[model samples]
Target: MIATFGGGCFWCTEVIFQHTKGVKEVLPGYMGGQRENPTYEQVCSGATGHVEVIQIDFDESQVSFQDLLEVFFKTHDPTTLNRQGADVGTQYRSVVFYHDDKQKQEAEAFIQALEEAKVYDSPIVTAVEPAVTFWEAEDYHHDYFNQNPQNQFCQVVIAPKLQKFLKLYQQ
Candidate 1:
């Protein structure tokens, strides 16, 4: 199964899915954009209409889409618009790019359930849309937290988020 999500920086989203038990591949990419084959620099300019995303291929037998949605809501602040932590701009918007009708329905139901449950202190503003062109980010963006743990963003932001995920959903 395929699950694409955009929640703030692709670096952090990619890292989180990579550690999930059933995930087969977590690729950093750009989606929901107008530009064709947008480059990292171009998307960063905030003109391409693309949001940084992670395309995850996972084993459905091992993990459900609902489970992934749970993790997604927990890891990022969905209340904020076009931002996650220090990452800002429309490129950092929270979104789920569903690959099929079933996925789309599930995503919508999940969002509704979260709202009814009051999962967040504020309203959840995650966007659920049909899957579009997924342009993989430049190779340097992959596994960024693993490769650059010493970086200030990794140490102060990504690391704590990863730790929280592990504590909440240990394999």
Candidate 2:
């Protein structure tokens, strides 16, 4: 099964999903945008209206979509609108582009449960839209954290999140 999520940087989200046990592939991409085949530079300009997203292909039998959602919510601040930590823009918005009705329903239920349970201090602003065309990111963006572990942003921003996710999910 496939699940697409946008919860800040695609690089960060990609790294997290990559560490998941049943996730076969986590392709960093641009989605929920007006532009066709948007480039990273174009999306970064915040003009393309594309959110940095990851198209994850996972084994549902090994890891449920709900499990993926749990990891996603715990790792990122879904309560914030169009921002995550230092990254701020529409491209960094919290979103879930559901592939089908089941995903859409599940996402809605998940958010409802979180709200009812008061999971966050603020309400979750994560958008649950129908899946759109996924424009795969440029080659360099793939497996970014693994490829450039020493990069300053990776160390200061991504590494800590990755650590927390690993501890929480044991991935």
- List the lowest-lDDT window of 10 residues for candidate 1: 66-75
Model 1 Cα shift for residue 62 (angstroms)? 0.6
Clashes of each: 0, 0
| Global lDDT of each candidate | 0.91, 0.93
Please give the distance, in angstroms, between residue 165's alpha carbon in candidate 2 and its true position after superposition: 0.9
lDDT of 1: 0.91
TM-scores of the candidates in the order shown: 0.97, 0.98
Candidate 2: lDDT of 1? 96
For residue 62, what is the lDDT in candidate 2? 94
- Misplaced by over 4 Å in model 2 are none
Candidate 1 per-residue lDDT over residues 65-109, each given as its tens digit: 988988888888889999998788999999989999988999899
